[model samples]
Target: MSSTANISTRTPDQLGASRAKAADNSTGKTPGPHRSKHRRLWWTTLAVGVVAVIVNVPWFNALIVSFKSDGDISRGALALGHPTTDHYANSLGAAGYDFPRFFLNSGMIALGAVALVLLIAVPSTYAAIRLGFGGRFIMNASSALRLLPAIFFAVPYFLLMSNLGLLDTVPGLILANTFLNLPLAIILLGAGFRDVPIELEEAAQVDGASTYRILYSVLLPILAPTLVAVSVLVFIFSWNDYLFALVLSSSNATPITLGAANFVTSTGIRWGDISAATVLSTLPPVLFAVFAQRFLVSGLSAGAVKG
Candidate 1:
């Protein structure tokens, strides 16, 4: 029969190898290489889990302290023996605290900054990457700005804001955060732009699409995930900014970062109140990340491979 002839045509070495493989499979023995690979994977997972727990211990303690009473916190015990909502109530409803206003200010400023950064960074990065307009200059300037500490610009920004009557105002904080976040947005978007294929633009142009049309209609859709990632990062950075908030705003424009300082009085640091405020301040960014996590992971991994 044809099957018998095909089997007899196999080389001796191939037959021996196939029989050995079958024997190993029948005996339920894994190949050495596969077993070693699984072992390495297991060890790697365990190591990462250990490291994650170590890093999160302080944050876990802070969460516990947020729900503890003042006396319980002062006792230096992480246990929530008598869990209470008094800290949350004080942080939210206390007259001098005004955390709701702080939350509002932070949201407004962070959103405004994100809007400005994406508005400017998107077009400019496209121009630099595709059109070769100020490519080196944009890259170098942004890189240099990244190298310099933000405090370096604090004096000039304060003076400029004061002269423009923008001090202690939401607009002033928005502008400051926009400036701080611009370089990072540009760098991130630049990478995404570079990863895009130029042939797509050429084809779009052949179809009578203008440069703006190609960028908006073609490239923008492709870069949507990266854009969302950049927006989230800029929003978080703007939300958590403290130095500019400390120096530039006093009362009217204070974000949560500055507002949290209200818990630190001349008497002493209110650990319970501070922890509660800290927990409250982190909610927006955490929720933002959770919602955008899908796009965030994809966008960050965009350039990892090539088709």
Candidate 2:
């Protein structure tokens, strides 16, 4: 069917009706279908807004109570009060919570894991996408491996780390994190690399630029945002890991996710302090999500189209 209401090929009576419809549209009377669509759009937008607020209620409550005193938290999770910095201090180890140490350990593992994942993934993904040597199989295998249960791999990694005397150490945690998250990094970073026009690579080759030089000087600049997005995702994964950290670490390499449990000991739950710790722990991932959101969006959108 045509979009125009004025169909010249219609019968005389049909043309009269079409002319009346076109006049109605021009005069803004339009039709019921368009009005119904507008109503549906407004209703959907309102429903989405309500759902978003509902989903974020808990986070808002946590933020509110994190600033309250131990006594004041009992008032309510959403209750407002003049806040104090005491919980922040205690959460950061002012009262011997060891958050600083936990932060250091988490940072070491997260940053190291991101570095290792990218180091292995970048060139490999680039080659897989561009070089075309069993690229399809490589992608399929990585995806399959990613879907396997963590325990399947963790058992072997545990034994290996134990034999290497790396258990309860930063490097051990980093290794575990990198191993678990590497496939995802490859799939994501490769998407950005895949989007890079092959003509650029060929042009560089024609100019006598080596593969490594082209990758470093030409591709790296284009991939900076993608790199940041990948790094942030990997960092969040490593930072928020509870299972691998719990299974692999003892006292030597406790991260914030595990260390946060200290507040729930037999001494009774320190709700205020826990809330504070939770709030602080939320910052890194949130900051990274905010900063790299554009690149992440672009990467995902491109991945959808290209893949």
Candidate 3:
């Protein structure tokens, strides 16, 4: 009986020691869940930052080059040596190029195109969504238009503009941009309008509001973010457009796109001036995108949720 009691006591103590050793081992070397997660997150963040720098390096280099002299730039120089705004000042002044006039012209054309797109797209999109007047057909037609090459329109548009005496004017360029961007604007705005709840429109109608009034007050406010997004997109399209501007604009009403083209002539190219002008021309769209990105995210999220 004593021997059996001693075996039981010894077995229990041995088991206790094994368990204590296991606990100590676990505490000493085992990684916590939070630490593993943090490590993974750090690696992901570092990878993304590296990719961002790689992608942005060219733009950064271009900006630096724009401020350097022609001699300094040609020797594979990366940094700004004797940073000078001479390129910018000359480009804007009579000494370099007619960039100031070109900028103004492009701005007007882009603004006009955006206005025209909103004016036409909003009503058409509203009709397509709310009234359902051949909505599917319209959407499909717009999509089909995208398949046709833009060059196909060039000849016809040129002839039509000539006949209308709009060849070489801001109005002519605006019209062309409006035509190019209209389908996209209609599709996006139509999708946005479709996401708007029917009950909200009905509620406004119940208060004895006309269709126009309801659209103006309730629907417009709800669609504000979408509108801003579309406007920014339209502006970018109009600003970057080179084809229409090149073909249609004359010296009297030339935009930055065409003016920039002039930098490379039969003679030697003006690399510094061209680089500076390119940077300046890109600024407005960049600023617009940065400022409107939040609204775009919110609008897209809202549409997704509603859908």
The prediction achieving the highest TM-score against the true structure is 3
What lDDT tens digits, residue by residue, belong to model 2 across residues 79-107?
A: 66788778888888788877788889999
- Return the TM-score for candidate 2, rounded to 2 decimals: 0.81
Error of 2 at 193 (Å): 2.5
Q: Write the per-residue lDDT of candidate 3 for residues 1-307, one digit (tens) a residue.
A: 1222123224555664575556656665665745654665688789999998898786777688789888877776654568777778777774647889899999999999999999998987798888887868877777677567888899899999999999999999999999998877777787778778899999889999999998899998988867887788788889989888878877867989888887766378767777788889989877865666654444334433332
Clashes of each: 0, 0, 0
lDDT of 3: 0.78
- Report the error of model 2 at residue 217, Å: 1.3
Candidate 1 lDDT by residue in tens digits, 166-216? 999999999999999888778778877887889999999999999999999
When sorted by TM-score, best at the front, the candidate numbers are 3, 2, 1
Ranking by lDDT: 1, 2, 3
What are the TM-scores, per candidate, against the unseen true structure?
A: 0.79, 0.81, 0.82
> Which parts of model 1 are misplaced by more than 4 Å?
1-47, 94-96, 288-307
Pairs clashing within candidate 1: none
Error of 2 at 88 (Å): 0.5
Query: Candidate 3 at residue 142, lDDT?
Result: 70
What is the Cα-based TM-score of model 1?
A: 0.79
